[model samples]
Target chain A: MNTNFTHHQSAHCENGVASNLLKFNGIDISEPMVFGIGSGLFFFYLPLLKVNQAPAISYRPMPGFIFNKAAKRLGITVKRIKFSSPEKAQIALENNLKNNIPTGLQVGVYNLTYFPDEYRFHFNAHNLVVYGKTDNTFLISDPVMENVTTLTEAELEKVRFAKGTLSPKGQMYYPTHLPSEINWESAIKKGIKNTCSDMLAPVPIVGVAAMRYLAKSIRKWPKSKGVKVANHYLAQMIRMQEEIGTGGGGFRFIYAAFLQEAAIILKNDKLKELSFEMTQIGDLWRDFALNASRVCKNRSNVEDVYNTLADQLLHLANLEEKFFKELKKAI
Target chain B: MKKEEIPQDESNLSKSNVKELCYATDENGNYTTGLSTGWEAKTIALESSINTINERIEEAKENIKSGKASPIVYFMELHRMDWPTLADYVGLWQWRVKRHVKPSVFKKLNNKILQKYADAFQISVDELINYKGA
Candidate 1:
């Protein structure tokens, strides 16, 4: 009769039995375990979980040639002059050029004068002007000259006639701010600030790569979804540029560090290639920045040089586009 | 059943219950319970502890089976193993991106996997040598 165990006895035993503590980890109980499963759970399991980590990158330095004297000598100027008419100014230049006396001679504003690189190429009245502060000695205010150069009225006329250039643009020389008046310190700081503004944005070069990818995908298939994807990606590219244009220098340093560290983490051939290209681009950007600082000493011209540099960077980005397409396929 | 219900005992031989109980007598001549070791309860405790360990090890082994590479290498090219030498390895890694993974964590994982295959071949060679000796 006792062989028929009552439910009441089993319930009492079950209640006395302590609950088996259940802890969940990814390991399946169905398979053969190694290193003792229960021991791992009680000891090393939690510590074995992977921790999130991102690689590090660094900021490069500005080169030495940026502050050189040759770089600082670029400037522009706008002075008031007493010419009868545009036609007269043109004739005066022609006659002076023939006689070897460039009549447009004027004294320098700050003991030294500078000329713009763009104007140096041509002898046109469009950008070139002669100034006369003293009697016979006319200061050849050829906006083209880097250092102060003078010519007599005859010399100016002879050169002008030989050059066969037309009249200057306006009637009387207006008092406009000259390019030389650009505040150098403010300009340089501003230029640096604007170029580096986009540093906070992550993997900007990769964003550029993504945009190119979307573009190619569209061309290949031309679906609405592809177009949407591309448009979304292109927006990031534009955002990257805008940030860089505003004030991203600090971010550039961070990106450099990030890339440098990433160069270590990436083990695949494709990732290795991408990271190397990225680092190389960073180096090229530094070189371009140094060249810009050297070529543009003052503020306004610095901005101009930076704009040109940005354009060159964009041209280089086109090459990245082609490379990324190959990457997408390979990946 | 009735005979089993009544505790079986032999008067001629000694029967051991094996209960170890430590008790102290107070000044009032009363026994105070101090310690008790019941064999059946102790055995249950030990068995449960061992069972918990078995469960833990099972979980760990499953995780290890499913675990990806520590650095996580996503290889699209299966022909990577076909490379003959280390000289070719650098070129193969740099072929697509024009850059090398300097630390070579990915390459290390590939080599480790390759060694496992080599072990099986080595076992075959050992067996052949033994057969010739025999």
Candidate 2:
């Protein structure tokens, strides 16, 4: 591990890495501030979208959206590269570290040797910072880790070039330029306005609107595909909600936290009220995930569990709908 | 999202191994993060995933022993996937993947296809073909 690399466990990886790298470049910001100013919180329920043929239920924006958007908003120019060859990617990272610059990487989680077997999955958007190297071992600062870790160059290449499902394609990054000063007010307003629009977008498979559709669709799963398949969907949702690492309540809680921070930064009292409401909704999501897991695990045939889950989701949909509306008005 | 909800007495989570960090308090009332350790429910989920991995590894061992498949079959199983999932990874049709699952067909696969599968498993092609079950 590099003695100069400061590692602190964070709630989410992208925001964490973004925050850390920015800090290293002489900018002071918290993860929640980065997430909020970037408008990282979102709820997307796409039944037709499949990751490995499993329904994609994302609670945040896409992989690069948070960091890229956050950087753009803060007028920070980060050197982003998508390499065509693993050899070239390896050399670029080595050069950056040689220059005493910390580099950020988008890596596959499944093959990283340092990750606990339990925490490892096939996710390819995982981010970490490579700070220093001794011989062949590259010191790593995965934002989610309690301490700095190390990975061999070979192991790092394996995951950096990890294939299948959102392949990393040897992508890595480091900050290039920092604005003399940031216009926090404009950025905060823009983030809130864009998030409100995204949440309230008039579409069937997106935003708060999709939450209603997901509830309706979930209720119909048993009749359409039998109890076994319905349970499968339930299990998938639970994993999407819980096991995806750092995304508690599918990221509702983090977003609520962001809102809490935004409220203070922007000095908007209404945003604070809205933050509390969103936290309650996040808690409800946790409750729904818990209930669904119970029903699925116990093989409960009591249809009430399913009904309650649906109702809870619908309640969430309603809550978010009201939230975005009020949020738009507040701004 | 707290120790109360997570199992307190988890054997896997000794205090020294815990990761400490800050968390937002949502409102400002009860919201400071500290030397929090691993969560109980998260541990259970991890244990379950490990169980799934073990089951798949076991099944692949039997398949390898039976010579119904190449060692690549074991890596697919290690990823907790089936033929279709592997097919999806390599962009090969199900029938092609099905055929390649057999040791005979896998022997005939070209370096390109082998590379594809190796890339999917995040291992060298040789490693994919030489995986020994633990």
Candidate 3:
């Protein structure tokens, strides 16, 4: 029942799934390209929502947004389904495999046995593709993995219906139609514009402002919550910035790659320069993560470590603000 | 990051033989894909969180043994779930879920409710009721 699907490793899940699925449908698009057109780069700080006992921080949009937006921009038709019953979900997946369709699924990472134990958590927005089934096992093409893997039917079912935040509930999607011609230049411009607006949004909990708000919170955490609780929150923030999926640094690098690609397609030299600037910003994010981890581990003797970290974040917000503004003008 | 500068620090990911894909710059400053074994900062963050979870799991076991908490509390900690999250999974009210953390309430729970908790934890009812330790 194999669809002859080729597994391609990606830094991020949704972009990887989208790219791989598109390639299987004969589009031959790259992962960065898909991410760029999808306007995948984003930032949000949700003080009201708590995940793992810490405030929710997201470097990308909600699950399915990337692929859906990319598909729409590329004029590709996609079908997405969610089933309440696990039996019905299994039937639908099997039918897709029988027809040689590699279906994308949203599942929980916690129950995915193939993932390393250290990476498993209650987050339930992980994406993978099921290309075939043999006996009771399904062939999996998880974009974050280096090679193809297999999951027993029961194991797949558990992950598909894993409880907690953003439960998958046996959701699956795949592209059904691809346009013969794609207006690459226009799509790239639209993608860049959308990203610019999102990042430069005026809202406090969103975009660059969110980064600033998070910085202010970081400075207050240690003084208000005590050292131990503050350290725990800092650790959680660093995990969201560095450990989850591709994290903040990895995503910026991907976006930089997208800008570089778009530069050639749009014949814009400014985008080429902006790509390098984005990479530098990505490096700064990595530096921030490194320093924040040091503070968390108590390896830093600096008395104002929290304040230092806050300053670093503020710098990032300023740089991103300027970068997105320039990107808007360039596009 | 430059391709040559991509971190290959030893961490849980590297120890498990899992390499992360990253975008880096080549000699010409052109974007390219590279594989990072791990990074020290991320390793520290991950290890700390895991350690915290392990500590909570240990505390839950002690609480169960001392009759201060129910077997459900132990299972909940093992599954990395909090009261509200467990309630969401089992489709129960948060206060009810918290109340069920009491050993007395857990002992009096009906089979249907126990089954719901078991399903949420991905364990059989027998295992959920009789969980000793991992």
Candidate 4:
């Protein structure tokens, strides 16, 4: 059975899935709008939590947070479930398809056959849509892919239950009810306000403080850890920022897009100016990634190189701090 | 970045015939979406991590040959897993998983434990037991 779902590629997976799923329900929202309404931009540096042997760093909030937050703000009722058994999960998904509901799923990326090999790490929490099923293959609408694809039953189950950190455990979600009227102005204001607070959060490991904390750690890494280990950590940090479906510059450009769209809807000229400033900050982040990659590739033992990178990060933190303060005032 | 400035440098995505979606500014300074083949900075970072994994795998292989580590160590590194992650996958205690990394302790493991490790690695018991680093 096919639900006649239209596929639209997006820069990030969660935003794509959220936007596509809402569109299927007749919301006609853009991916950046969904991301903005969801308050998806975030940064966290957890030194104690080890992912792939390096301190866990995330450019976005935990998976599913964006979709859930957006749904709640828009007064949409979404059904989410996690099945203990793969068989039950399959049955639930088939039921949704039979009812003409396009289902969103949280899956591990490592065993997703359609993904490019370079992108397939053990990272779980990748989101996709399963719209139809025939014979043994399920139609897949992966947001990051240029076009829709399919996955066999066995292949789907493997990734659903891919064992590791953040194992999906056969999780599936779908919007059951969308309100008749959504107050775009209020939602937009709330989203912008929350994002400003999140970025300027008081904690050291979260938001702008976390960025500065990471800068301090980067300066220490070369001296405390050897050059090889330091390089590996830098590689991990860059991978989290640039790779893994973050659009271009760690969701900065995407947020800027949201602001531009918000500026039109709210007709706030100040927002338009801040949107441009955000784009410049996104460019700065790309510059940091480029220079940091050079340090990793050169295996540079020079401590000054790391110091330069740290200064770049500190500069970014300062810019973000001022930008968020201005954003909060504009709203 | 400007729409025209989006990097299309050849990288793994280009080799795989995949283009990633990026948000860039049009000439009007408005945000627009564009497709990029890849970026060299991202490719380098990705390759560095993969290289680190491969280096660990090679070290694990050498340790297995010297009888200092078990075949499990090789497969763990091959799968890009560490002791804690593998233990989480196999539902074993951290210390037990560490014990299973020793050549002596691994050889004494029964089929039940071997089966668990095999399932975690997505390999058969026969392959897990008989793997000789080839």
Ranking by DockQ: 4, 3, 2, 1
TM-scores for every candidate against the unseen true structure: 0.18, 0.86, 0.96, 0.98
Model 2: per-residue Cα lDDT over A108-201, one tens digit each: 8978776655556678899999999999999999887778888998899988977666778889998889999999888888888888998899
Worst window of 10 by summed lDDT in candidate 4 chain A: A114-123
Candidates sorted on TM-score, descending: 4, 3, 2, 1
lDDT of 3: 0.89
Q: How high is the lDDT of residue A154 in model 2?
A: 89
Which pairs of residues have clashing backbones in candidate 2? B7-B40
| Winner by lDDT between candidate 2 and candidate 1 | 2
Question: lDDT (0-100) at residue A133 of candidate 4?
Answer: 95
| Candidate 2 Cα outliers beyond 4 Å, as residue runs | A1-4, B1-30, B34-74, B81-95, B102-134
The A-chain TM-scores of all the candidates are 0.22, 0.95, 0.97, 0.99
All models: lDDT?
Answer: 0.27, 0.75, 0.89, 0.91
Which wins on lDDT, candidate 1 or candidate 4?
A: 4
lDDT of 2 at A88: 94
Q: Candidate 3: misplaced stretches above 4 Å?
A: A247-250, A299-303, B124-127, B130-134
- Candidate 1, residues A1-331, lDDT tens digits: the string is 0111101000000010100000011111110011011010000011122111101111211211111111222232223343535357655544544543223222212112132211121122222334332344445433222223455554443333221112223222222222434343333223223222322223432334332332343233214334323222222222222111111121222222222333333333553454345434534544443333333222232234434545555554475445444533432
Quote the lDDT for B46 in model 4: 91
